[model samples]
Target: MDMWSYFYTCLVSVWLHRLYVYSAVAFGISLWIVIQFTTTRTKRKGKKSHRNPSSPEGTSDKVGNGCAPRQAQEVHVAGVKIFYGSQTGTAKRFAKALAEAVTSLNLPVEVINMGDYDPEDGLAEETSSRNICVFLVATYTEGQPPESAAWFCKWLEEAANDFRVGKSFLQGLRYAVFGLGNSAYVDHYNTAEELFETSSEEEAGGTDSVVDVEDLGNIMGNMKKAKREQELQEGAAGAERREMITPALREALTKQGYKLIGSHSGVKLCRWTKSMLRGRGGCYKHTFYGIESHRCMEATPSLACANKCVFCWRHHTNPVGTEWRWKMDQPELILQEALEKHQNMIRQFKGVSGVKAARLEEALAVKHCALSLVGEPIMYPHINSFVRLLHQHGISTFLVTNAQFPEEIRRLEPVTQLYVSVDASTKESLRRIDRPLFKDFWQRFLDSLKALAEKQQRTVYRLTLVKAWNVDELKAYADLISLGKPDFIEVKGVTYCGESSASSLTMANVPWHGEVVSFVRELARLLPDYGIACEHEHSNCLLLAHSKFQVDGEWRTWIDYGRFQELVREHQRSGGSRTFTAADYTARTPPWALFGARERGFDPLDVRFQRKNKARDISGC
Candidate 1:
C-alpha cells in the first residue's frame, strides 16, 4: 500500500513540475511581447510628435499630459529693396519687372512705393554691404517731386528737421536711380535724379550756388595766360591779353576740340559746315529757312550759361554763371575777330576734295551768324549791339537762347531768326532737364515765352524730342506753344553722341526719322493752324509752320535775305521805330521743299533720284 501511495505522489509531483515549466515559459513569452509592444508604441508616439506641424521644430517635451517650453528661433532676410515714385505707373511696372528678374538669383526683393516708404523705418540704418535700395522715380510738374514722393523730397530738402538722423545719414546708404523725364523741359526733365544727387551734395554742403563774378574774371585771366603760353610754344605768339578763366575749363574746352574766342567766347565748326565743305549740302535750316549753310558762322559771344542742359552736346565743359562776370570784349572787336577766325577756319577746307571753290568763297563772306555754338549767346551784355553789328555788316543773325532771362529777351533787338528752346511742357521737367541756376527759373521761363509772343521778328520754338521722355506730353506741349505763339516749330530728334557726363542719354533715346514724322503728324492733328512744312531725313528734324505762312498753298517760310537786309537798314535809319515783321521779308518756298512733296528737297538732278525714277517708270511700263 505504501509503495502505491508513493508512486501516486511522484506522478502528481511530475505533473506539477511540468505545469510550472509551461506556465513559466508562457509568462516569459507574454512578458517579452508586452515589452516589445510598449517599445514600438513609444517610438511611434515620438515620431508622431516630431512630425506635428503645430510643434514647429518638433521638440515637444510632455510632462504628465502638458507640453513643456521651447527656445526661440532667429529669422534672416536676404535681398534688395526697391522704391518707386510713379506718375503714370511706368516706374511701378519697372520695379515689378526688376523684382521678378532678381527672383532667379535666389534673392528676396521687396518693392515699395515712395508714398508708402519711410527712410526712418530701418532703411536708413541699412549698410550698402548687405542691403541696396533702388529708386525709380519720375519728375512731376514744374521741377517738383510727384505728389506721392513729396514727403520724401521735402524730407531730403530739409535734412536739419530730422534730429535722429545726422547729415551723413545717407552716407551708408547705397542707391541707384533711374529717372523718367523729358529733355524738352530743360529745368525739370530729370529732377528726381538731380534731387537725389543734389540732396547728397546739400548734406555735404556742396549744393551749387552763385559764384562771385571776380572769381570768373580770375578764371578767364588764367585761361588767357595759358593760351598765350601755348601760342608762344607753337611759334604763333601774339599780343598777351589780360584775362582770367578756369584752367580746368580751358583744358576741357581744348580737349573737346573747341577754338577759344577771346576770353569768354568759343567757336565750333558744325557737322553741317563740314558737310557743306564736302558739297553734300547744308543743314535742314538751309532748305527750310533760306540759311546759306556755307556762309553761316557758328559762334557764341559768351561761352558761359545759367543752366546745365542734359542734352547739351558740349558735355557741360563750358563755364556756368548767372551773369557775365568776366571782362567784356566789345561787340565791334568781337565781330572783326569772329569774321577773321571764321575765314581762317574756312581756309582749312579750301584744298579738301568735294569743296566747291565758289562755295568756299561764299563761306568766307560770312553772310550769316548762328549764335548757337555753345552757351547762352544772349547772356552776353553786348548781344543787342552784337546783333546790330551783324546787321550792319549785311550778315543775318540767328540767336538761340535757353529762355531763362525774360528781361533780357524783352529788351533784345530783333534778329533775322530768334529761337527760344521750349524744352519742357511742364515746369517740373524744365527744372530737371535744364538745371537752371535761377531758383525762379520756371517763372522766368514763362515770362520769356510771353516775351517771345510779343516779338515782331521771325520767332521759332525749337523742340528737341527724346524718346520715352518728352514724347508723350503732346497736350502740354501744345499748351506751351499757345503761350509762345511762335511762327514756326522745329521738332528735332535728340542727337545721342556717345555718352555724356551732363546727361544720361543713350542711343535708345534717339528717335528715327519715321518716329519724328509720326510725332509731328500727331501734333499737327491737334494744331490745325500749323502744318507739317518740311523735314530733313538726315538730321531727323521736322518743321511745323502756322497756316498763315501758307499763303494760297505756297509756303512762305523762306526769309527774303535781300528784303530783310533792306528792312534792317530801314529800321536802323528810322531809329528802330519801324520794326520789321516776318511777313514783311517773307519769300516763296520751292515746291520740293514742302514736307509731302515728291522731291522732298532732294535735288531733282541728283543721279540717285534719276535712277529711282527711271526704275519706277520701267516697272510701270
Candidate 2:
C-alpha cells in the first residue's frame, strides 16, 4: 500500500507540473497578442499625431500632407491701396472688384476697409512712393461719411489742427477719390472733395495731386462694370441711364430715397402722395382742378429747362437746353415710360403698414399728370403731342412753364390747367430771380404772359414769394397779374431747403404763412378784378380768382372736369379750332374750398361740408 501511495504522489506531481507548464504556455501566447495589439494602437496614434502637426502634443513636423507649410501671406507694402467706405456694401464690393482688376494687370494691389485701416499709421509713407491710393466711398445720411469711415473723415477734417499731420502732409501722396451720392440732397457729394481738399490743402496751396487724372475714367468704368454685374445677378432688366448718374448725384438722390426714371426723369414720393396712399389727404391741386391728388402722377416730360431760377428747387443739376438740341424722345415713348415709372413709384408702398391697399390700387391708374416736376415741361419738343397723348388716355394734363418761351406757350394746346411761373414783379427782379437764358427775357416774359391771357383753358400765374426779394413790389406784381389776367394766382412762400451757392438766400428769406397771407391781401387790394378764392395752409399757399368767376357772389373756382373733357373732345373733333374758354366749363366751388370761408379748403372728412350740402353752402357762404 505504501509503495502504491508514493507512486500516485509522483504521478500527481508530474501531472500538476505538466498542467502548470501548459497554463504558462497559454499565458505567453495571450501576452504576445496583447503586446501586438498595444503596439499597433500606439503606431496608429503616432501616425495620427504625425499627420496633424497642429495637435496639442507639439509635434515637430513642419510639413503638412508631404508639402511645405504655407508661408504667411505677404502684403505688398508699396502697392496701390484700394480703401472703401461703404454703408450698404456697394462701395466695398466695388473696391474689391477694382483691386482684383488692378491685380490682373500684374500690379500689386491691397484692398482695405477704411473702417479697419488706421489712416494716421504709415498711410503717408505707403502713398509717398509711386504707389497710388484709391478711395471708393459712399455718402451716408445728411452728407456724412459711413460710420466706419467717420473717424478717417473726421481726422482729415481736423488734420490742420493735428501737429503731427500737417495740411500738406499728403503732398507727395497720389490719391483719387470716387464718391457715391444722390443729386437731390444739398451737399450730397461735397464731402469727398472737402476731405481731399482739407487733407492736401489743394485749394489753398494750388498744388494738385501728381496722380494721372486719366485713371479716373478707367476707375469709373470698373465701378460701372461691377455695378452692372451686381445688378444682373439681382435680375435687373437693362442698364438704365440712371445708373450712369454721377456718383455724387446718384448718392444724393438715393440718400433722399427717390425712385429715378431713366437718367433725367425722377419720381419722388410727396407728402400728399403718401397721405393719399394712406387714405389720409390729397394734393393742393385736388382742390383746384378737381384732380384726384392721390391718383396724380407727379412727373416731368422734359428734365431740361432753359432757365435757372434762383428759387428753383432742382439746384440746376437738370440739363439746360436753349432748344431741342438733345435727342428728342417720341411723345408716345415718353408717355409710356412716364406712366410705367409712375406705376413703379406707386408699387413700392405695397405691404406698408399704413397704406390702404384699395387706395394704392386706385393710385396705380394715374388720373392726373403734374408736369410741374422740377423742369419746364414745355421745353419738350413734342409738348403738344405729349398733351394729346395724355388726354387720349383720359389723364388730365396740368402743364407748367418758366414763361421764357413765348413761342412754346403760344403753340401749346389747351390743358386742364396751364401754369406760368411769374418769378418776379419787375424786369430787374425777373432777370435776377428767373435768370432767363434769353437776353430779351423781359420781353419774352411779357409775351408769355400775353399769350397766357389768350388761353381758353384754365390759366394760372404761380408766384413763389421770397421774403425781402420780390415780396416788396406789390404794384409791379399787380401790373404783371393784369397783363396775364390769369384765372387764378397762387401766392406761396419760398420753401427754404438749404444753403444754395447759386442764390443769396437765407432762412430769413423764407416768409411765414401769415406773411404770405398779408402779402396776398395787399396784392388783392391792388387788383380789384381778382378775389381770394382758396387757401392751403399746409402748403403755405393762397389762390386768387378773377371776379368774373364769382357768379352771384358764389365762387366758381372748382373745375367741371367732365365738361372740360367733353369740350376737349369736341375741339378735337372740330380739328382743335373751336377753342373752349374757362367759362365754358365752369363749376361751382364749395364754400369750404373758398379762402377764409371755413376750415381751409375742401376737408373731405368734414361731415358738415359734405358734397350734399356743398351747393347750398356755395350760394351764401
Candidate 3:
C-alpha cells in the first residue's frame, strides 16, 4: 500500500480492534451484572432472615451466646411481658406470636400495647417487679418510634438525662428491643436510643426470624447462667424449698430497715447513709475513700450469711449458710430491686426535718454500692455480673467479704475497692468471733488474703475490732497484714447489737474511741508501708493507708470517683484487655477528711446533731 493509504488502513484496523475489545468488555460486564442480579434475587426470594445483626466486639457489650440452646434452670421468671409499638398491625402480631411461643414453653406472658401505656407511671413499677419486658417496635419513615411508643421514648431519654427522673430510673429492668421493620432503619429500631439488639429463641410462626434462648437467657433473664449452675448442681438436695430469706426472716429484716429483693438480695439504708441525707455526717468510707455516703446504696445479693457473729448490728437474725443452696435471683433483678428499694427508703425522708431537698435529690440517684450489708455478698454466684450492673450505671462498687470465699475472691471482677474482713487476726480468734460455717474457714481466710494480694485494683483489710475478742492479737494481725500488702487497713469498733441468741457480746465488748486509737497506733508501729491515714470520729473508725498513697507527704487516700468510672468504662470498652491499678484513679485527701482534722473526718458542711441515748450517742448520730 502507499504510505498514506497504509497508515489509514492500519489506523482503521486498530480502531476496529479497539471497538471489538470494548464491546466484549461491555458484554462481559452486562453478563456479570445479570448473573449477580439473578443470584441475589434467587437468594432473596424464599430465604428468611433469622439472625439479628450483631455489632462486633467493642461496639457494644452483648451478654448472651444466641447460636446454641441452653438447658433450663431452677430459677423461675418472676414476670414476663411482650410489649409492642406498631404503626401498622405487624409489630403487634409479632408480639402476639412471640407471647404464644413463650406460652408454649410453659411461660405465661402478657402482651402489652405501648400506646396506652404511660411509661413514667408504669415503667418504674416494672423494675421493682423484676420482669422480662420485651419490646416489639416497628420503625416508620425515619429512625423513630411510632406515635404509640413516643411517650416511652421520651420517658426513657428523660430517665437517662433529666436529673429529676434520676439517671438509672429504669435500671435493673430486663428488656429486649426487636425491630419489626427490615434493615433500612436498623440503627433506630424498637426504642428511641437503644438499638434493636435481641433475637427470639422461639420462632414467630416458624419463620426464619428467631432469637436464641441462650442470648435471651443472659441479657433478658440470666436463664443460661442459672441453668449452668443447675447442671453443675444436678443431684443437690431440695434447692426449691431453701429460700435464702424465708417469709418470717423477711418480716424480721423489714422491721430492721431492710427491703428484701428477689429470693436472696437485700438493701437497707445504713445509719451513716441516713445521717448524710440529713446533712448530719457520712460514714467512715467517706473519710477514707471519699465516697458520698448519702448517695451510697448498702445491699447484699446473698442475705444468707456464712457467720452468725455476736456483734452483728441486726442481732444476727439473718439466715446463715455456707454454699448457695437456695433459689438464686438474677443479678439484673437484684440490681433493679436494690436501686428502687434504696430510693424508696430515701423518699420516706422527703418531709423529714433535716433532709435537705438537694441531698434527697442526690440520694435518689445512687453513686456507690456498699456490698457490706448483713451477708456474704461475694458468695453470690453472679456477683461479677451484679458489679458490672452497678458500674454500668456509673456507680462505684465496694464489695466486702468475710474472708471465707478465697476462690470466689480470686474469680471476682474488678471493683473500685475490694475489702476482705479480717474479723480476727489469729485462726482461733476468727473461729471464735466470725463463727464461720465453712470447716476450712481458717485456710479460706488465709487464701483470701493471698488472693487480695494478687488483685490489680485496691484491696482493703477491714478489721471489726471487738475489745475483748480480737483486739489483743496485734502481732498476729501485723503478720497477716504483711502478707496481704493491702492498700488500706480499716479498724473500727464492733457494732454491739442487742441481746442475741447467736452470741453473748455486750456493750462491754465494744471498744472506746480512745482504745481503738491506741490499738491502731500500736499496730501502725509494727507495720511498714502503712501509716495512719484517716479517721471518722463519730464512726470510731481508723484508717491506715499504704505508703504509696503518700506522695510527697500528701495522702492520696481518697478516690476520684469520676476518674474511676472513666477508667472502668474504658477497660470494658477495651474488652478487659487494659488493666488499671489503685493509684490510677486516686484523688488527694481533703484536709477536713484527714485523720487529725477538727471535724475528725466529718465533712465540715454537715450539721452535727447530738443525741441523748447511749446507742445513738455512741454510734455517732
Candidate that scores best on lDDT: 3
lDDT of 2 at 234: 57
* lDDT per residue as tens, model 2, 469-558: 898999999888889889999988998777654455788988998999999999999999998988876578899999989999998887
Cα-based lDDT at residue 151, candidate 3: 76
What ranking of all candidate models by TM-score puts the best one first?
Answer: 1, 3, 2
Deviation in Å, model 1, residue 16 alpha carbon: 99
True-vs-predicted CA distance for residue 294, candidate 3, Å: 1.1
What is the TM-score of candidate 2?
Answer: 0.58
Residue 96 Cα positional deviation in candidate 1, in Å, after optimal superposition: 37
Off by over 4 Å in 2: 1-266, 602-621
TM-score, structure 3 vs. true: 0.61
Local lDDT at 530 for model 1? 97
Better of 1 and 2 by lDDT: 1
Model 3 lDDT tens row, 217-311: 23433544676678567646534544777778888888887888988888988888888888888888887888888999999998877765657
**Global lDDT scores for all candidate models:** 0.76, 0.73, 0.77
Q: Weakest 10 consecutive residues, lDDT, candidate 1?
A: 66-75
The per-residue C-alpha lDDT of model 3 at residue 234 equals 65
Candidate 1 lDDT by residue in tens digits, 1-621: 999999999998988799888989999999999999999999977876555222333432222211222222111224668888876576789999988965654567889898987765655566444445677777865666676778887777677346555666666454556677644455566777678656755453342321111232234346568976775665455445435347878888878777776788777677777777656656788879878787888999999888877688887777776766567788888888888887888899978877778888878898888999989999998899989999999999889999999899999987999999987788777766777777788898989999999999999999999887788889999988889999999999999877753366799989988899999999999888899998766678889999889998789999998899999999989988888799999998876667877655543322221244355321101
Per-model TM values vs. the true structure:
0.63, 0.58, 0.61
